[model samples]
Target chain A: MKKNRLGEFQELVLMTVIVLQDDAYGVEIQRDLEERLKKRLSVGAIQTALKRMVEKGFLTSEFGEATQKRGGKRKRIYSATPYAHQVLREMRDLRAQLWDAMPRLGTSQA
Target chain B: MKKNRLGEFQELVLMTVIVLQDDAYGVEIQRDLEERLKKRLSVGAIQTALKRMVEKGFLTSEFGEATQKRGGKRKRIYSATPYAHQVLREMRDLRAQLWDAMPRLGTSQA
Candidate 1:
């Protein structure tokens, strides 16, 4: 399997899409990221990541129902592809393995 | 705290260094990454990541005792700095939060 290369911000955006499930649009993902990470993020940055991931096959986006709340604009909802989940699992396993291999040190507490 | 920006390959190298602990030199880290990741990684790539991370303050290196096995040349062992651990923690927490928020779906199993 080819490795999935994701930058830190891209990974965060991808995870946010998974977390949001059916409600994952650009604005909503940005909001969720800000809330969870406690850091301000530009909508453009999120959009760029979303676009890049979509191109990379880590995420798929489709137009959702046109909502009156946003003047009948149909939001583009993003969802994690199976490839995304696979990469995430790989990342989690790699990190866990490294963490497990760490020697117990008195000075370092994380 | 400033964000520790690591690319996917860089993150893998960084984690591999942490996994190797006291034995984390370029050759050893490359070997461990190959074993765990089941993929051949270039020595140059690993060395570049180690150098970059050391410059970024995510890792520290120290010269270890020379051995006759490899012509008695001192090896520079790399270790994860507290900053690296902190970033790893942040990444873990973020991923966990996103994973927790995900709705269970029959189609997706990770």
Candidate 2:
């Protein structure tokens, strides 16, 4: 099978989904990313990216039970698929390979 | 300048544009990417991505002189800017650092 490539934002978003665990949803994912990356993100953009990821099979989403607090609007929770996890591992490994080839990264600047 | 993040496809396209150098036009870029990646890409998608990259300042485009080969349609040539080059370097360095942190990557797996 061919490997799917993740965009920079896609990878970060995927990692965030993992970090958020079962609580991953549009609003929560956006909030978590904002907090961690210290970057401003629009809800619509996050939703669009999330939808795209889902279509690409990197993520799976399901509607959570509606809560009275939000007037019965269910949240669409997201999680990384097994494929996503494998892709992340591969990316990490590829990055690892490139890093190991460089000896002066963490050393003194000379 | 704020560090801009690259998407997987965006990075691949940027790298292809860089590889194509002065000959980097839409058709050549599309063809080059298809040849190197062994994937089919639409002209519209490539053009859209290229336009987006230009908007993000990761790429710059200029109209090349219309050649008789293309029936007088000037090709839009793309090139990575200094900012793009810096981002690529940073990404490479980041990958390198991550790789070096993995001690067992290149070692015998037991």
- Alpha carbon lDDT of residue A57, candidate 2? 93
lDDT of 1 at A60: 86
How high is each candidate's TM-score? 0.87, 0.56
Q: Write the per-residue lDDT of candidate 1 for residues B1-110, one digit (tens) a residue.
A: 75557777788788778777778899989998899888888989999999999989999989999887857688999999898888877777878888788766665775
Model 2, range A49-86, lDDT digits (tens) per residue? 88888988999999888888847689999988888878
Instruction: Name the fnat for model 2.
Output: 0.13
Provide the clash count, candidate 2: 5
Model 2, residue A88: C-alpha shift (Å)? 4.6
DockQ of each: 0.65, 0.12
Highest lDDT against the true fold, candidate: 1
Model 1: residues >4 Å from true position, as ranges? A1-3, A70-72, A106-110, B1-3, B70-72, B106-110
Question: Candidate 2 has what TM-score?
Answer: 0.56
Best by DockQ: 1
